[model samples]
Target: MLLGLHDHWQELCHCHVSLSIYLGFLGAQGKFAYKLLNDLFANYSNALRPVEDTDRALNVTLRITLSQIIDMDERNQILTAYLWIRQVWVDAYLGWKKDAYDGIDSIRIPSSYVWRPDIVLYNNADEQFTGSMETNVVIRHDGQVMWDSPAITKSSCKVDVSYFPFDGQECRLTFGSWTYNGNQIDILNGLDTGDLTDFVENVEWEVLGMPAKRNVIIYGCCSEPYPDITYTLLLKRRASFYIFNLLLPCVMISFLAPLGFYLPADSGEKVSLGVTVLLALTVFQLLVAESMPPSENVPLIGKYYIATMTMITASTALTIFIMNVHHCGPGAKPVPKWAKKFILQYMARLFFVYEVGETCKSSKRQPKVRVVDGRTEEGGHQPRVCATGLCLCRHGSLLRDVEYVANCFRDQKAAQKRTGEWKKVAKVMDRIFMWIFFVMVFFMSVLILGKAI
Candidate 1:
């Protein structure tokens, strides 16, 4: 009985060892089995041929995830994005039962070994691809093919800069199979919506949203509709940089334009100051133009700049007019009565301008004179007319000379008064204009900045 039991135990151990060796052999065979894959390919004449008949549609699904926005050129109307493009489709010929080869579930194969859709971007701007196209293809036991590739694609995008630096843009990447029509290739969206959860933020732009759409187009020449996938990227510009560097300076310069009025007309620098500020504004405008694409509708900043320039030009012209008024000499016409009443009396008082009493008092002061024997004595010693009647008769000339001298003095006094009045009128005008310019600048600033804010 003991011999029999020991023999039974030995047989059990032998059976366990044999089972282990057999399992090891099966595992090794499962790993080294390329023969089955080779057999499958050998049976097919062209691996590149799609499983569907040439006339029947081969449904292909697409999934895209944007990784980054490499660059967007407004001037060139180009958009460059780094994307992971995934193409999923089932190849009926490549399918094999999992039980056929020790439950092999999936395989990684070269993309050249299988059929792939000839997808191309309809609006491609670059002549050559920005990334490598050679990649591995994943195949499941059920013949589901997943071809994922990372690409840096550059495509044409129509740019509208009407509201540049504060504007939002919509750009599209349209993809379609180049050689297959909708009848031959049916493109489907892989996800319910284009996923943007993995999108990397850009420094100059912020992604508002991304939406995907499928379109079918029937060309006039072709009877079949072509399948297309369009991904629209909505982005807004990050305006902080432009606002600080370009807009702030322009606004400051515009404010300074009005300060030119503070320069006294005698300084001869008002025109030069205005023109310098005008040129600086022009340079800022050029900077804006260089940064943005040309468009028929003006940008908000451009409009502001133009308005500022208009104000500056008007101020310069007014400066020139004021200088002319201030420089009027004795030869010029006297200030008009209405102008004196309105500007010198009413407007000057309204603007808080004080009348110059010293000039008026000096002009009104009369020269001291002593009359001797009914004749005026000049310089306290020289006699203007002789006391003798014979002298007067010899020169009724005496009366005529005195009268002529008196008229000369009266004309000189009148000219002095006219010159003073003209100067007062110029001062009044300058005050009025300064107030006008101040109000204009204030209103313009509010309007422009309100729009920007």
Candidate 2:
């Protein structure tokens, strides 16, 4: 009855020789008798042959062939095998191509612009995905998706995709193929849709070498966005970032924190601004460190951090020096001679004049004021007022208006006196440390910037 029913349908036959495979597997399962039974039942179509079930979607037949898979001790695989798939359609062939430009734009479409579905899937019996630090993309025959590592390599689909990669793009491919025992089935459900518009990306294809193994790994990167979904595969990679862009800015900003040395502690803005910049750099450093891999050797930017912190620490120390000088000091250290004599003269009058001349004559000239009625203008403001400015304004203020001109002159003297006292307080530092630290920081920063350049 089984023979009569099966003979009435179309029969397909393929020989499968599983000598060392299934027998060994059955032996491990304590089912060694199945090997014996298989041998005995080899000639019987009635014993272990197909029993048709009308409920299944695809009809399947099972046959035990009395053959041996070649000993294959010196087996050589075919290096180049064109993929053969039952194609539903074939588009226009790329026989020839021409390159042209519309206006200043380049349009690139060569004879190689032709694409084909040449992806192949081969099974490696030993490769397996373990569910640990690794991940395997899982795609069901029905298209449901999930990811988990399988203990055994029952099935894998190998593809050398040239349709969806670019020079530096990145993408990740997940697997859903899994096997439980030795008899696991790897079904090739096949491509359901073929849409070339689904993937218009850069190509990441390169030939790789494997001596003792067969693999389909070619270099690939992220794919560009497509207009539709057409069974895309991608491999994900962690984005790479430069240490300078990632960290140096914060370190540099932090390094700027110590510049409060120029600020008078008596002014309300000194420590407040310094401490704020310090906190900002610290926070930025912490944030930058989060993106870095853990390493014992500090990054180049980390060295910058240390150096910058050293400079900032020096700046902070100078601020402390200024505070001490303003409050109390020994031997009455004179004010910075440069700040008093040369710096005030050259910087305020000469350097400042040069800067003003450059500002006035430069190509980037903008709106600027020619004079100030005590209300200052932008870009003309300096960090600190020099005694030269006091002297400049001395006779000018002395020539005041008729509205209590004597009182205005007295107030002007008081302001000048305050400026002189501030200078005197600043003079307590032996100008030696300021000049030394300035040159040191300048030289070091320039060296670092040069190296970076």
Candidate 3:
């Protein structure tokens, strides 16, 4: 039984050795295949393009995937985008069938070992910016070259801030072959639209959509029509930030004009409030100006701010005029009958303003009569009875005293009349301006916000 067990163990060991040899051969074959691919690429010259027919244009297709919008500089009119650019073209010299090469379907070689189209952005702003050239290129067995690399592209754009903050911008990136014209290279879009599957959201801007188009243009200088692919990226400003930070504050400051009217003329703060609000509006205007690029046409927000400032300034001047009218002294000309009737009677009632002098008149006290030694007298304790049964003071003192009281009454009436006239004028002015300001604000709001919408 021991001899029979030893023979079975030797047979198992021989089977294990045969399996190891088979695995070794597979590994060797993989190494040989890799070596063959390397040898083939070693003799490949990237400088030599495989263009058999110079007249037949090399069909190059472009695909771009927007990874992120690094920044959009409105002041400089530059758009910086992070993109994954893929370019595909056919190279007849690199063709090899899978049947001729042990079923090798595709191989990756250094990008320098193949011919590549010199695709360039016609509107590129940064001359130093270039796509990554160290990435590997994939060559299929059917001679199709697929090259993809990350590019930090900076392109110039024409910015129209006419409706800024709520504006939509269409910026384009045009790609075409630099050296080879339409005869030698024909560029086409690989996708109907740019890929945004991996797009990174921006804080101040949002991507609306991207559309790609191909166009052929015949330049006056060049007879061959140059083919180019254009990718248009539609971006809309994220206005919520600007609205909260800039616009809301401006609107609030504009409303301060009404507060100036609420301030009493006696407090001497009406003009000051109006001036302060005007300055605040000016500061906001500067802030908005700093955010937008300088252009011949004013942006919608800027125009609104300017109109607001003008209104506020006019309101301030009107406040000053109203204060002057309220403080118009007694030395000035007496209030005209027509002016008093219109401002004091009609406008006062219309504005719900009460007359100060009328209240005082209704509550005025009568002159007290006092019993003297001889008789009753008005306005004086000492008295003498005359023949007419009226009290007369000694040495015509009653006459002088009567004249003095009459003079005092006259002066009080004049002062009260002046105060009433000034108050009436102020009230009328305030009411008129309140309506004016309301209309101004309403129209301005509609004009500004309507354009944004």
Task: Put down candidate 3 lDDT per residue, 278-366, tens digits, no spaces.
Answer: 88888888887886788886888888888888898888888888888888887767778888898777776676666545452253355
Q: How much does each candidate deviate from the true structure in C-alpha RMSD? A: 12.6, 23.2, 11.5
lDDT (Cα, tens digit) per residue for candidate 2, span 1-453: 889767654242111223433443353332433333343235434221122332322211111111111111111211111111221111211111211111111111111222212222223222342222223222222212222221222223232212111111121112221211111211222333222232223222221211121112212442321111112222221212332454446545654564465555567565566566666656655764564445453544555556666666666666666676565432343446555665434333432222223442443266563334443346667434545755554455544543256557657766654455445445434243445556665665565445433
The pairs that clash in candidate 1 are none
Evaluate model 2: give its TM-score.
0.30
How many clashing residue pairs appear in each of the predictions shown?
A: 0, 21, 0
Full-model lDDT, candidate 1: 0.79
- Global lDDT scores for all candidate models: 0.79, 0.35, 0.80
> Which parts of model 3 are misplaced by more than 4 Å?
1-29, 356-397
Instruction: State residue 27's C-alpha deviation in candidate 2, in Å.
Output: 43
Residue 8's lDDT in candidate 2:
53
